[model samples]
Target chain A: MKTKTAPVAVDVARPRPGPLALLAGARRGRRKLGRRVVPYVFSLPFLTLFAAFFFLPFAYAISQSVFKQQRSGLGLGPPTTIFVGLDNYAKALRDPQFWDGIKRVLLFGAVQIPVMMLVALALALLMDSAVIRFRRFFRLAFFIPYAVPGVIAGIMWGFFYSPSFSPIRQLATTTGLPAPDFLGPGLVLWSIANIATWEFTGYNMVIFFSALQAIPQEIYEAGRLDGLNEVGIALRLKLPMILPALVLGLLFSLIGTLQLFNEPLILTRLSGSITSHYTPNIYAYNVAFVDTDYYYGGAIAVILGLVTFAFSFGFLRLTRRQSGV
Target chain B: MRNWRHRASLCLALFLGVASVLSACSGGGASSGGVVQLTFWSFNQQITEQADLFNKSHPNIHVTALKQPSGPNQYYPKVLTAVKAGNAPDVALIEYQYIPTMVSNAALVDVSKYGANGVKDQFVDSAWAQVTQGRAVYGYPQDTGPMGFFYNSATFKKAGITHPPATWDEFAQDAVKIHALGPNYYITAFPPQSTGWFQGLMWQAGATWFSVDTAANAWKVSVNDATSKKVASYWQALVDKGLVSTVADFSNDWNAALNKGTIASWISAVWGQGVITGSAADTKGQWTAAPIPQWTAGAKTSAMWGGSAISVIAGTKHPQEANEFAQWYLTNSGSLSIGVKEIGWFPSNKTAQQSSDVNAPQAFYGNQVVDTVFEQAEIPTTWTWPPNLTAVNQFMGDDVNAAVANKTPIVDALDKLQGQIVQDMKSNGINVAGG
Candidate 1:
């Protein structure tokens, strides 16, 4: 039978490969399609939406930033809207208030981000600790402030900041402590930072806790075997593992710090301390609505957007380089 | 087959979601049982009360009132945006200062179409001027906020001052006397919250914010001119003298100060009667009304401040009902009485102003004749606000506040303001000359 099997395999080539070969090729094609086309098909919707909403508007804003409306004479008789290349950007660059806003935001970022991040990280670690009791209740309690809308939060904080109606001021007076003017130039930024932290610390804490949870139990077990304590594991393993989330939180906080408006605006209304051009967003808003310069406002918005993008990208790159990732 | 079924279900879910979202975004109001639901927005108390009264009388119509967040600076932009989005209210309450913007934007209906039949002609001439634009009557005069002075009688007594001053010099002298009594206290209120108030002062001094060339339709900056400079410099001196508190206007501090007798007098309009008398309940009978201090000798009788008008949106479905309600509410004797008594709003109608309710002494102010006092201060041919007065007010107010805060010098600030305001007016496509 062995000798007969060798003789049967002797005919290796026919005039053409028969229906079996074609069938095999068709099967391979189906497999290839399932592997490649299916994934692309699944991803199409998300890509489409991103392109439509985010990318399109961003492109439009960048384009609009380069142009300005220059009106001649009385500016009453059908004023011409001409393209003055880079003039809008130049004007924005030269504006001292705009630069001052940037400097203020930078200083705000320097103080606010680290303090808020550290607080959020501590909260997350505490929440994630196995020793912690009533974890669900604690989790919700910490996150309650995040559930409030920004405008509503601003309004509530505004009342707190108001010297006349504030319970804090009342308490201070009763305790014989000087009621620190939250809206004053010296304290306005911190007051606003407090509001920001109140708003987003819980949200960021939840993010960090989620990232902590995602770390493998095996890694912790390995750490235990290596004689690392809980604190040691958190510092060396857990924190590092969650670095991406921390970085993301920092980026988000930085962006929010730049667009500081509602808190200052509401505070200004509630108190008398915040000025009209207190923040860049407020400056842009006053320019558009109060000053009726939608064009200039548009330019300011574009500049803010670019600055945010640059910051986020630069931050990510720096973190990547530092981590050697 | 199972995979196909799952895919089909997914597609169906997506389709339904999209349909629902699209329908929600594009949905128009459906008339419920032959009743037309009309949305009405108002910032003024008197105008809103009128709308509510009209709604009660008309069964076929339903009017919903949406109160805007405070400040004319916030109101008009929201209204404009809503109008552009085709979601505007049928009836809107607009301040007189914003009427020009509305008219220029073509957002207002020509109320003149209804003719003079039911419309009252007794509104003050300046009030009527604010409502009318070109050949079209944009709105009915809802309330007349004729300028006046409200003084804390206790503070006046403390300063040993008798009779409210009639001229700027006398007012300054009174302020000096009041300042002698306290460090931060002043004889009058200067609002950092409002640039229009400053403009009103300038106009009282016979100065304009801008000069218009009618033919060219361009507005030139007059903010740095002699008249405006003089007014700004005077205010600066007041700030320097430490008579005027660095505390800006319309703030809790300012309001609280008023209650605490920190501000001796507020140069306000008739509507301010409500704020002073209502909020500071303990200070009742301690307040009295007088004419706003004139800028100098030979200034006009008075100027308008913080007044509102009632306008119908251009694309409203029920024009007749809207107009009828507007007219009946603003001009009717009963509605006007409610405004004065409940809300402390001044009646815009000439006949309504003559009502016993309007002429009655308010109990809060120790029987001070606020109605009669403000009535005498109504000046017909005075300052006219540009359509973009809101813009101008904001810029000027900001600069004034900046100067007060020592962020910039008064002259430099005014110069910057002049430059910025002109640039802004042009960008907004406002006839710079006329503005």
Candidate 2:
């Protein structure tokens, strides 16, 4: 196994210097010109699109968030946009609903990210096991739900949650047992998490499975020679090898949990189980659009974006510090 | 190597040049045939179909109708962005409640100019009132959605009731009786998810959520007023007795219950008939419509549920054609009848209200003249719309839901709602501190 790992290490080291050596041989002035000109040529199309959609509107949203709209006496006249620095942010921060949503998502993320990651990891390992049959079929079957659009998935699950339309409910009735109230206030969060897990577990499994495949067979053979079984190999060998992938999955799940919107929004009509402020994204969406308070919505969005950025960057830093990467 | 670099640079330059040229050509397509393609947006599919019908009748007019998805959260930002871009649709189907917001943004075209000869008078007086911003007519009325009681006959029979209840007290009594028949059965399904409907109930009970008559559309905390509390208490008792499902916004449970006859009746919009009948094929003859039992003898003549109207854009290139199309869609008897037959939308045109199709009995509602029943119950139009009607609806929905969820007491929820709505308005620069 150690001998097998040597070739990959050599390959990584050998690829780096060729590009640097080319630059070293160039004339000083030409090197400067090439470095400046090459990246711009490579980035021109991306920069154009970024300017057209993201940067321009991002700037506008930031500008819009700093201002507030006011109407004069009688509220009879048209509202005038007034420039107010940080007031929108202050109002959003002070809002109990907004803070509650933020706190709820954080707790949701803490539970959901680990649960999803662990399930995905377990499934990926099970599929990779030597005794597993029809691996490709099982992998595809698991991945099928990811292909269904979120809105459609929400609607489909909504039927299952409904007593009137649910086949599950009918089956339960035939058995002389009560159907589970999926939309009950007590269990709606977990029900939503169940959906997110069903939709994404396969996608995450594919990620972990790919990471598992990259592990050479020789390492497993060595573990076998040391009398390590498949379970031992997974615990001692496979798990550590897939740490980066696990971290990647965890980060994605965290972000997804924070930005949860589509399922809850679509499922609103299925049961009175969800409110407009159920999730932070939904809260921002409601404030911005339904409430017509774009300034506050923008503030909430900015806050959420910052939270996502902080969590992502903070995780990357923590992983790097721990792994010594 | 040098030649390769030069060729690569040329390729890059050529790629950028072609991209810019194509983008310019696409921008040019925005204006074509010496005509500007004015975009019109609406929430209702029926309204979009009606617009399409009007466009067909009048040639040389190209109005693109964009439907606002059923949920307002997904719809309003698109309208806001389009307006902010200085390229909003030349005409839009603005629901009556949304006129104030559109007017506030200075995004609407004043249709009052086209109505120089009292053309605005052609619509139901209250329908016209929704579009008016201090004497300037902003849009033409398209439909009116007066509230009514739509009951499932099968469920009623099961409860041993021969007629739909005629008063709130009787309604509750019947609801309790229905619940007694089956453990999970409910008398009626309402959007316990929304406070807007709660406010409508308060209105029926002779109280208003806000002081709409005041210069400032400020919260008067009237939801806790005696009559309003009575309305809330009745519903609360129903919920306590398990006579009403503790469902949030119209969820699958609500729809399934309605279709399964687990819910005996529904207090819904004049337009809800379209959704209910359209979604359930087997329940056609099983349903019927009656006047929504009044809270008191004359507390309210009626309370509206849903309605929308069309407006021409102020800066549109084809104002004349737009005006012609708007007038035809809103007031023309032929065009309005098409809206009813094709899409089941009730027309707001006073003349069309008497049309054979408008007055015709619906077979689905046990062959009752459901349309005529809706017209007769038309509320006196005392309630007015705010620019932030969507927010008002949302807040109303949330606070009421909190009460229903037992997360807060009714008075506490109302107080919370009052504070939040007022604070929200103030943060948005609307003065709600005083009337």
Candidate 3:
């Protein structure tokens, strides 16, 4: 937390000013070097951490990806790490399990994100309308699910999805209705999506709401002068105005969905439907940690990294193009 | 587009954040004043009782046992993290199934140097072979899982069954009789997700899933052989006819089903007695243990479902102390008696195994000496647990589970995963026979 602010505070609080301070005096010029160096000194801790935690590990993973551990002669001893030169990447490229995991999350994202964003957009718009009572209470209530961490939310919903333990199932059965098996093979992916939607829609709604709040009242006034009704003005003017916010929300959802891990993982023990490689993140986690196949796992991570980048870039471009019209 | 660096940074941070956290383990164990402070990571929390006794008796070495929960995820990674830190717990309780993987990772120190060979005659031959790869001994054989047929006698009587099934032929007949008792009744729930349980069945049928060809320097995988196929088809017939319930074991539904007497029987190992009694507490005196039903009428063979060994980790600062503790605790009668009470560990140590503490009649089990019943079935100590058992088990479970739900043949599941398992081993640089 301190790392974020430290860099900015360090940069601004330097004794020497910018080039503009050179005009003051020679004494000031002499002190300028110390002032300029002060920012780097303060940011050094964060930068060092960034290098160690991010850059070095990134480099290490990259190094590991091109190499794999090899064994021979009953494979009893410690395996020798060998340079295979993209062999792991090539193997992962053809791995049905890895691709299946990727496809699963993509489908999860495709259905979950749009529906979730729609609900978020509706909630954001309703709040911005100022026609609703207990606005603060509704906002707080919606955001509460997001405050429950993903793992806890997953475990909580896992209980709800379980047929034997669920109150919903009990009520349904008592009413002489056949209870739906939420963790069944056909329904589990969507069940996980429901958990994600519940946890994240509120957080994304807050984002959309804040962006809507940033809009000027003059735009709506202008719409009113054009003989537009409240609904008409809100739909045509306010919606287009929050295009950037919508794109941001979509981007976050896309990223979140692709990295789907927690809910499915928690549900795994309860559900026979979810496989070991249920999602790319979970697959990578299991391969590296459980299976101890670090090279392949690292390759999967980097491939996922590339895929995430391409999706974000493409989504940003598409939204930008649409906004231009 | 403009802040690409920032976005990429955030994404990478999110993805790699968890993996990098593994490097943050700080290990604590020190030898001061000639007293070895040893840490033992055990999933069986009750083992701490033995650790307390070990500390008290062995004045030179104080063992600190940390309770680690067992699962596919929880137990392994914590030990791996400490292995990475190079100051791992001196001793850790790892299941026999996982030992090969740990050995391949070089995460465990071979105790052969710590007079392990001298005490070789003290353990079950198969268990000793399991802990050793060639001449190198990796751990001390602690508890073993020779299975038994645990049945609800009341349910059997209600179904008009006179006695427990002594053979697979009779087991099937009993299944039908039980099914006739009620629409919901079943002979036993086939744990769809349990590869260990299934493998135990295969083991019972004398089906060799894995074996090492020392001369060829490769593992011979015989998963879908005729022997195993016969076993699979026999079980599949039961599943297809709705005689056996297909429930995920350790699940809420299975627990409820067992409690309600809808699920009437189990063919599980020694520790499963605890699971049965713990889940179906109301039916305390209704249950009893028998020898695992044989393919042949009087065959005394059984398959193991669950068991673990006490292994000294590779990077321990006190290997001597660790190995000392592992050897003493596993072979010692004191530890066995303590384990018999605190944990339901069926001893691999032959001497302590015959002790009264282990063979006593359990009240919850209808005054049955459940231990002696399971001891009659001979467990194959020579069954090779492949280094890639986690993947093997995962793929097996995946195939078998899908097949059970889809009404597909169970042997097809074995044939389906055979290639995957072999390929997995080969990719890991293991020499697979005919791969």
Give the TM-score comparing model 3 with the true structure, all chains together: 0.89
lDDT of 3 by residue, B274-380 (tens): 78988999898999898889898777999888788889998888888899999888877778887776688888888877788887889988898888887767876
Top-lDDT candidate index: 3
Docking class of 3: acceptable
DockQ of 3: 0.37
Which portions of model 2 miss their true places by more than 4 Å?
A1-36, A43-57, A167-178, A271-273, A321-324, B1-31, B46-53, B72-77, B194-196, B212-221, B248-252, B297-300, B313-317, B378-381, B433-435
Backbone clashes in candidate 3 total: 2
Candidate DockQ values, in order, are 0.25, 0.30, 0.37
Worst lDDT 10-window in candidate 3 chain B: B18-27
lDDT tens string, model 2, A1-325?
2343343222333345676554544544575798899888677777876776678767777878997778754354667778889988887788778878778778877777788888999999998898889999999999999999998899888878775677887899889998877777776777788888889999999999999999999999999999998899999999999888888888788889888988888777655557788888999888777666678788888888888889888888989843445
Per-model TM-score of chain A alone? 0.83, 0.85, 0.88
Candidates 1 and 2 compared by TM-score, better number: 2
Best by TM-score: 3
State each model's C-alpha RMSD to the native.
Answer: 6.7, 6.5, 6.1
How accurate locally is residue B28 in candidate 1, as Cα lDDT from 0 to 100? 40
